[model samples]
Target: MKFNRRTFIKRLFIAAASIETFFLIKGSISKTHLEKDKKELFNAGKADSFEKNKPYPFLTGQFFLRRFDDGGFIAMSIKCTHLGCIVQSNIKTGGFNCPCHASQFNRFGEVLSSPATRPLDYFPITIKNGDILVDTSKPTKRKSFSKSQLTYV
Candidate 1:
């Protein structure tokens, strides 16, 4: 059982690889459990808190709450359609700008510039007991903005 330099290096490499593999598997298993335990619907907040025709960003939820002038609500995903980059809301421009690719989207989630051929994805909104809940589990993709997509009170 004499330990040579070559043997030590080989054993070290094997141990490192095993440790890496174990961490990878553990991370994936934990992620799966987290996904399973996550709630499908997110309680945004009281309906009154959102102003009309304004976009409220939910950074943690990865979506934006848009209240239309007609008292309609839309839960739009911040992810850009062009390359899945998180879009930044530009208050001055009244649109979203993707830092990764510069794709622009209007407040309605409509693509105002190129590179993003489709509009931003959105979640379904449900008003329950004066609270606005967004179904984050399922995100619907749209080619363009439509009046029917608005969830009115």
Candidate 2:
């Protein structure tokens, strides 16, 4: 049990390596947990909160929640398919207009003009206990709007 320079240096190096290894593993585990936690579903409030045939803009979430007359909901992304510009909602027309390239989209996100060949992207909507939840993590891109895209309550 004699204290020697070589032994002390070796033990210190081993301890330092062990600590670094532990930290690296811990960081990776925490990152993975955070990714799992970030499912990122935007809660759009109660189902009854949104009026029929009206577009509710969630700026922070970057999506528009459009409620149809038949209790159907469609969450469309605000990012314009043409050059990724943020589309502005035309309340009077109940459609979307892109300021960047003058791309127009109808209420159903269908493309009305050029510069954009596809319709506006949309997120998946889920109804839980009368609440509207839009999955903003990933948007579904489509060439046109269809009845299947609408979520009915």
Candidate 3:
């Protein structure tokens, strides 16, 4: 094998460049998972509480608010886990169904079928400053879920 200084330096440079590029891609993927989508076109407290009988997706929060049997509400996530597409609430059916793949989730964000193994990602809610606030930053651990977890408008 013939060894030359120029060839040795070229091989070393190529190896270093490839390693740097791999690290850069890894960092970007990690950040995308952490960062929530900023296109929160809807703000909380934007819509007046309407009668449950009306068909309306609540403003600010994700899904439409419905009066449960216990008189509580559940705020379901609008983004579908399957493909990040927005899921629509089938008011007539009384649950949210993803139009993309027909993945159905109950108002409580439960997985109603096979395509989606996990339920809808929930947003934490707290009443602050006389308005219902939804913090979309950190996701919480999944526990025994009930439709009651959905926040009402």
Q: What would the TM-scores of all predictions be? A: 0.73, 0.76, 0.55
Tens-place lDDT per residue, model 3, 1-153, is 999999999999999999999999999988886665542323456324534433346544654444455444445567777786788877776767888888987766677864766777765665445455656553443544765465544
Alpha-carbon deviation at 8 in model 3, angstroms: 29
Better of 1 and 3 by lDDT: 1
Model 1: per-residue Cα lDDT over 20-78, one tens digit each? 99999999999999986675888999998888877899988789999888888999999
Residue 108 Cα positional deviation in candidate 2, in Å, after optimal superposition:
0.5
Ranking by TM-score: 2, 1, 3
**Per-candidate count of clashing residue pairs (backbone under 3 Å):** 0, 0, 6
Query: After superposing candidate 1, which stretches have Cα over 4 Å from the reference?
Result: 1-39
Q: Cα lDDT of model 1 overall? A: 0.89
The 10 consecutive residues of candidate 1 with the worst lDDT sum are 33-42
Tell me which residue pairs clash in candidate 2: none
RMSD each, Å: 6.5, 3.6, 6.1
Error of 3 at 117 (Å): 0.9
What is the TM-score (0 to 1) of candidate 1? 0.73
TM-score of 2: 0.76
Give me the candidate number with maximum lDDT. Answer: 2
Q: Which regions of candidate 3 fall more than 4 Å away from where they truly are?
A: 1-43, 46-67, 141-144, 147-153
